[model samples]
Target: MLDIGIIGASGYTGGELMRLLLSHPQARVELATSRRLMGQKVSATHTHLKDMVDIQFENPDPHEIKDRCDVVFVAVPHGTAMNIVPKILDDKVKVIDLSADYRLKPAVFEDVYGIKHLDPRNVVYGMPELHPEIKHEGFIANPGCFPTGATLAAAPLAQASMIDSVVFDSKTGVSGAGIEPSQASHYPNMAENVQPYKLTKHRHLPEFTQELQRLDKNLTNISFTPHIIPSVRGILTTAHIFTKGTLTKYDVMDLYTEMYQDKPFVRMMDGIPSLSAVKGSNFCDIGFEVDPRNNRVVVISAIDNLVKGASGQAIQNMNIMCGLDETTGLWVPGIAP
Candidate 1:
């Protein structure tokens, strides 16, 4: 069994990592660290895991952490994980960063986040369906929530070099904001309302561009806009893909089917995907419709922002890195109504 350690375990993503790891047969959470909440119970902030996780938060030395855990998940925020990751990372312990720090190239990360990267090590972009090379890497940079859904929605077409340009519009739940309640996530302001932020230049846009561009170098015309919805746990992305040529519905479906046939977590649906169908699960349910008149293929993808979008995806990467099936501990259905 692999002993797991989660650094910065006082937030939404950290709580999620603890919750999911509880059911993993080959994994055990040995450490959950939080500087501010040191010595406090993990379930104090993550009440949902009250009875499930009995461990208290502790501030452990990074070097000591490396020796205690076989796998370490850096669940800290941007600019913060960089401080912790380099200390705990070693050949014997695999590191998976659930932050924006290692996802982009050093220059790009500095440009987007406006924070200098102290440690600029090469790591696999851990989107299992897209990067099979993840299985061979010891360090993984987990994809951002918005980029995860948005990139997957357009990957098949991008890979086939059929896309002329694409616009990604995403609606995300409040949990994506984090555990801290902000003015935008405030109940009065966010309730019965949809707020769109960072319209033209969201940070995650670069990730979407980077991943898709890897498949097709010419696939550069990508636009993304994200909105905050009233709900609390999922992200649904609508990709308006302007294809190079006319594509019949059957033709579009065939391409997607062929691309994701072996990918267990990506579920291609006959109808449009819904957040309710994929909520609380580590699955990206995708569907598409071709609008022949406009030569636009609208692809929709749904995923739990905290699961497939963050922690669960981290676990998925861990499984692949450890030579286990990608779906080993995450092959459950979403919580549906």
Candidate 2:
């Protein structure tokens, strides 16, 4: 069994990783690190894993972590993973970073995040559907939650060179904001309201654009706007893909089917996908409609922001890198009511 270590284990993503890894037959949670929560039980912050995880939070140096874990998941904040990753990543240890640290080019990451990238290296972008090369690597940069849903929603058309321009309007749960309580995540403000922030220049926009552009170099017009919904855990993205030509629904469906045929986590739906269909699961449910008159295709995708978007995707990368079935611990139904 693979010995797993999770850095920044006090946050939502780290907790979610522990929750999912609990069921993996080939993996075990060997270490869970949280500086402040050191010596405390992991179940304290992650109440959902109360009876499931019996491990205590420990804050060992990054160097020591590399010795203990066969695989390490860096689930820290945006700029923090760079620090821990450089210390823990070695030939013996594979790393999957759940941060924005290594997803983009060093220059692009610096420009978008407005922080100097301390450690920059080329690593496979962790969208297994797009980058099959991840299976050959020891390091992976897990895509941002918004980009996970938005990019998957429109990737097939982009690969077919059918997109002229695309606009992604994504609704995400408060959990995407992180476990920390903020003015935006404040119960009163978030309840019975929808707050749209970073209208045109959200940071995740670059990631979505970068992934889609890789499919078709000439495809350039990509815009993304993210909103925080009143829900607790899921991202529902609506993509308005203005195509270069008029296509029927069957034509679009064919593209999605061909692209996602071998992908176990992507579910193509006949009707629009809903958050309930993907909540609490690693699946990304996608569906689209054709607007022939306007030469447009409206696509929608749903994913658990914390699952397919973050921790779950990190684990998916692990399975691929380890040569295990990609769905080893992740092939389960969503908690739809």
Candidate 3:
């Protein structure tokens, strides 16, 4: 069994990772670290795992973590992972950093994040459907939740280089904002209300731009606007993708099917996909319609913000990196209402 260690074990992503890894057949959580909650039971923070996971949170040195784990997931904030990851990478421990740390070119990362990238290197962007070759890599930079859903929605059209402009309007759960409470995520403000923030600029925008460009280098005009919804666990994205030429419904469907046919997590739906269908599962449900009059294809994509968007995807990357079947711990269906 692979010994896995998590750098930050108290946040939503970390808790979700612990819950998923506990049941993994080939890997187990060997170390869960939280400086403030050091020595506290992991279940104390993640109440649902009370009896299932018996490990306590321990704040161990990054260098020491290298010896304890064969694979490590750096689940800390944006700038923090760069610091810890560099220390642990020297001992041959495979790593997947779930932050915006290494997902872009050094210059692009600094531009989008507005912070100098202290450590920049070529790491596979961990979106399994787009880059299945992650199966052989030792380190991966997990994609952000919004980018995960948005990219899958537009990837097929983008790959064909048929897109002239794409507008992604994504509605995300409050949990994506993390454990820290904010005025935006407050119960009163978020309940019965939909507020759009970062309308013109969001950090995840760069990831969408960078990844899509790989499929077609001459593409431009990618816009993103994100809103916080009342829900607690999903992201539903509507991608308005403009095509360079007219295409029938049959044509669009054929493209997506051919692109995602080999990918297990990306499901092509006959009708529109709903959040409930992918809430707890490691699947991205995609559906689309061709608008002949407007020359646009409206694509809808749904994923659980914490699962397929984060922890579940992280584990998926781990399984691939370790040469286990990609669905080793994540083939279960989502809970639907």
lDDT against true structure, model 2: 0.93
* lDDT for model 1: 0.93
Q: Over the stretch 1-337, how does candidate 3's per-residue lDDT look in tens digits?
A: 9999999989999999988887788888999999999988999889999998899999988778998999999999988888888888863799999998999888888888788888888889999999978977889999999999999999999999899999999999999999999998999999999999999989999999999999989887999999999999999999999999898999999999999999999999999999999988999999998999989999999999999999999999999988899999899999988
Lowest summed lDDT across 10 adjacent residues in model 1 is found at: 81-90
Instruction: Estimate TM-scores for all models.
Output: 0.99, 0.99, 0.98
Q: List the residue pairs that clash in candidate 2.
A: none
Q: How well is each residue in 1-337 modelled by candidate 2, as lDDT tens digits? A: 9999999999999989998999899999999998989999999889999989999999898778988999999988889988888888789999999999999999999999999989878878999999999999999999999999999999999999999999999999999999889999999999999999989999998898899999999988999888999999999999999999899988998999999999999999989898998888999999888889999999999999999999999999999999999999998899977
**Cα error, candidate 2, residue 7 (Å):** 0.3
* Tens-digit lDDT string for candidate 1 (1-337): 9999999889999999998999899999999999899999888888999988999999988788988999999988799888888887778999999999999999999999999999987778999999999988889999999999999999999999999999999999999999998999999999999999999999999999999999999988999999999999999999999999999998898899999999999999989999999988999999998999999999999999999999999999999999998888898899997
Per-prediction tally of clashes: 0, 0, 0
Report residue 212 deviation for candidate 1 (angstroms): 0.7
Off by over 4 Å in 1: none
C-alpha lDDT of residue 34 in model 1: 91
The model with the greater lDDT, 1 or 3, is: 1
